[model samples]
Target: MTTNTEPALHKSLGTLQLWGIAVGLVISGEYFGWSFGWASAGTLGFMVTAIFIAAMYACFIFSFTELTTSIPHAGGPFEYSRRAFGPVGGYLAGFATLVEFVFAPPAISLAIGAYLNVQFPALDPKIAALGAYLVFMGLNIVGVQIAATFELFVTLVAIFELLVFMGVVSPGFSVANFVKGGWSGEDAFSLASVPGMFAAIPFAIWFFLAIEGVAMAAEEARDPKRSIPIAYIAGILTLVVLAIGVMLFAGGAGDWTQLANINDPLPQAMKLIVGDNSGWLHMLVWLGLFGLIASFHGIILGYSRQIFALSRAGYLPELLGRVHPKFRTPHLAILAGGIVGIAAIFSDELITFGGQTLTANIVTMSVFGAIVMYILSMASLFKLRATEPGLPRSFRAPGFPVVPGFALLAAVVCLVAMTYYNPLIAGVFVGLMALGYLYFLATRSRRAVRAATAV
Candidate 1:
C-alpha cells in the first residue's frame, strides 16, 4: 500500500467527464442545503449572504483553476500548499479537504434517505443512507470510468429535472411569499439578523459545495492543463443559474417557513402547487433522486482521491492509499471513506445541542473545511508567485493577485463569521483539524527517526 509516488489513476476522463465531475459533485446543493439558509436569515437575508458567497466562489474558482492546472496534482490543495510552504501547510490543506469532502457526502447521504422515505414510508432513512454508502462505494471501487460515467449520466438527468421543476413551480412564483418575514421576524436592518446572515453562510455554500472537486480529478484527466480550467469555469456558471432558479421558484411557491427547515424543498414546493396526488409531485419525488445521487456519488470520488493523496504522501496510514491492481482505483481509500461516512450517519443526531440539528452542524463543519483550504491555498498561491516567478504555467489566474487576494479575504471573513455565530460547531471542527495536523507531525517525526537509525 505504501507508495513513494502518485499511484496511477486511469487517465480516461475527458472534458465532458471533467465537467460532470465538477457539476455532479455540487448539484445536490441546489436541491436541499439552501433551504436552511431561509431558517437562519430569512429569504432576503440568505440571498444577500449568498450573493456575497457566490462572488467569493467565482474568485476562488478562477484562482483554484490556476493552481490545479499548473500543478495538476490529485492532492489538489495539499499539493499546491506543500510546494509553497512545505509539510505543515500541506497537512492543513489536506485535512481541510477531508472535512469538506468527507463530511459533506454523509450529510447528502442522509438527505438521500429522506428522499427515499418519500417513496417508501416503512424504510428507515438512516438504514437507507448506510445502504447508499455501500452501493456507491462498491461502484467507486470497481473503477474510475464506471464511477465518472455514472456521475455524468445522473448529473444530466438532474439538470433536466431542475429545468422541469422551474417550469412547474414558476407559475406560483411570488415576491410576496419570498419576502414574507424576509428577516426571520427580526427588524430588517437590526443587529440581531446580522449573525443569522453569517450563520446562513454555510447553507448558502451548499449551493456550490464541492464544485472545486473538479480539481481532485485533475490527476485522472487527459490534458488536464486545458480540460481542468474549462470544467471549473463552466461548472460554476451552470450551478449559479440552477441555484438561483430553484431558490426563487421553490421559495416563492410556498411559505418560506415550510421550505426553510426541510431537505426536500423542491418536492415540497411541487406538492404545494400541484397537491400531493399530482403527477408533478410524483415526478419531483423520484427524479429529484438523481440530483442527490449526482452529488453523493461524485463527492465520494472526490473524497477518496483526497484520502488517497494524503496516504500516498505518507501523511496518513499507507493502507488507506492502495490502488487495486486489477481495477486501477484507490480501493482502500474509497472503502475507508465509506466507513467514516456510515459512522457519520449514525452520529448525525449528536449536534442538536443548541437548536442546531445534526445536518446543520455537519454542513457548518464542511464549510469550515472549505474556508481553511481556500485561505491556505490562496496564501500558497501568493507564496509560490513570489518565490518561484519563473515556474511554468499553462494557465494563469485571470485577475492574478487581486482575485486570489479577494478570495482569501472573503474566506477569512466567513471563518470569523461562522466562528462568532456558531462557536460550538466551529470549536469542534478546529479540534478535529488539530488532531489531524498533529498526526501528520507525529508520522513525519517517526519517519525521520527511522531514516536516521538506518543511516
Candidate 2:
C-alpha cells in the first residue's frame, strides 16, 4: 500500500495559464511573420495554404491531447516516448526536443533584435539582443505567475495589433497582388505540382511547430486532463484562425511584395497601410514586440521543465535537477537556459556560413528539429495503443484508430514534405537525432561502469 509520506504529485499551473503558455510559446510575435512567409511560399491559394498549415497543426494537438492526459508528466514529449519505447528512445526524443528549445531562444531573441532595429534604427542590434535576453531572464527568474501574466498580456496585445493593423489598412486592399501570375507564372493561385507543395511544407511546419510543448505542462497543471486538452485545442485554433485572417487582410490590402520583403512584416504592413510615419502604428508595432517577449518567457519555462526531467533521469548533469526552494523554480535549469541563449546570441552574431544567412539557417534547422519530434511523437501513439491498452487515459483522442491513424498519416506527409522542401536541413535533423542516439549510448555505458565499480 502507498504511504502518506509519499511526495506530492501535483504542481501549481492553472488551466488558463496553461493555455497562455502554450499559445505564447507557439504563436506569438515574429512567428507569425515566419508562418506568413512560409505559407505564402506555397503554390496554394492564400486561404488554402493557411488552412493546410492549421489542419496539420490540429492533428498534433488532437494526438498529443490523449497522450498528455494518459501520462500527465513534466517531461513532455520525452516522457511519452520513454513510456512507449523505453529509456534509450525516450532520452533521444527528449534530447532532440531539448536541442530545439536550446536553439529556439537565440533565434527568437535575434528576431526580436531585428524587429527592434527596424523600428529604432539608431539602436545597435547587439544592445537590442541583450535587452531581449535580460527581459526573458527577468520574467523567468521572478516566477511563473508573473511570467504567465505577462504572456496573457502579450497575447492580448498581439491580437489587438493584428486587428487594428488589418482593419485600418484593409481599405487599400487589392486582389491584384495575388493575381500577378503566381510564383510559377501560371496563376500563383493554382495548385499545380506536388513538388512545389512539398517544398513549401517544411517552411509551413516551421511556422506551426512547438504545439507539443503544451502537453508537457500536464505535470504542473492544477488539472492535467482538463487543462492540457483545453489549452492545446483552444490556443492552437485561436492562433491559426487569427493568423489566416491577418494573412488574408494583408494580401488583399495592397503591395504584398513590399510587406513580404520588409525585414519585419507586421510593422512594414502597418507603415504601408497607415502611411509609415504614423506614431500609433509604431506604438502598435512595439505592442507586437511585447508578444515576442511573452512567447520567450513561456518557452523558457517549458524548456526548463524538460531539462529538469532529463536531469532527474540521469541523462543530463545533476546540477540541472536542483530546484530553488525559495522561488520554487528550477533555478539551475533556468540559468543554464540563459547561458545557452547567450551563446546562441554570440554565435548568431558571428556566423554567416554557406549561402544562407545565419538567422535563415537557424530558422530552417529549428523547423527540421520540430518536425522530427512531431513525427516521432505521433508514431508513439500507435505503439502505446498496442503495448499499453491498459493505461488509463483521462482525455481520449476522438475516433480512436481513425483520428489517430489520420494523424499518423499527416505526420508522415509532413516529414516527406519537409524533406523535399529543404533537403539540406532535413538531412541535418536526421544527423542530429542520430547523434543524440549515440550520446544516449555513451551515457548508458558510463552509468553502467559506475554501478559496477560501486558494487
Considering every candidate listed, which one attains the maximal lDDT? 1
User: Per-residue CA lDDT of candidate 2, range 1-455, in tens?
Assistant: 11232122237788888877777786653334453343345223434444676777786688878888888777878878877888876876787688767667766777678778877889876678778777777667676666677777777776677677677777776667544533433453444533455555544554556667776566767778778888888888787877666666666655566654233666666666777788867776677676666666777877787887777566777678776666666777877877877776677544434444566556666666666677667778879988999888888777777766766677677667667756676666677677777767778865454335552
Residue 330 lDDT, candidate 1, scale 0-100: 92
lDDT of 2: 0.67
Candidate 1 per-residue C-alpha lDDT over 317-353 given as tens digits, one digit per residue, 9 for 90 to 100: 9788789999999989998888887888888456565
lDDT of 1 at 272: 80
Model 2, TM vs. native: 0.89
Candidate 1 stretches with Cα past 4 Å from truth are: 1-6, 186-191, 445-455
Q: Please report the candidate that would top TM-score against the real structure.
A: 1
Clashing pairs in 2: 173-252, 173-253, 182-188, 199-421
* TM agreement with the true structure for every prediction: 0.96, 0.89
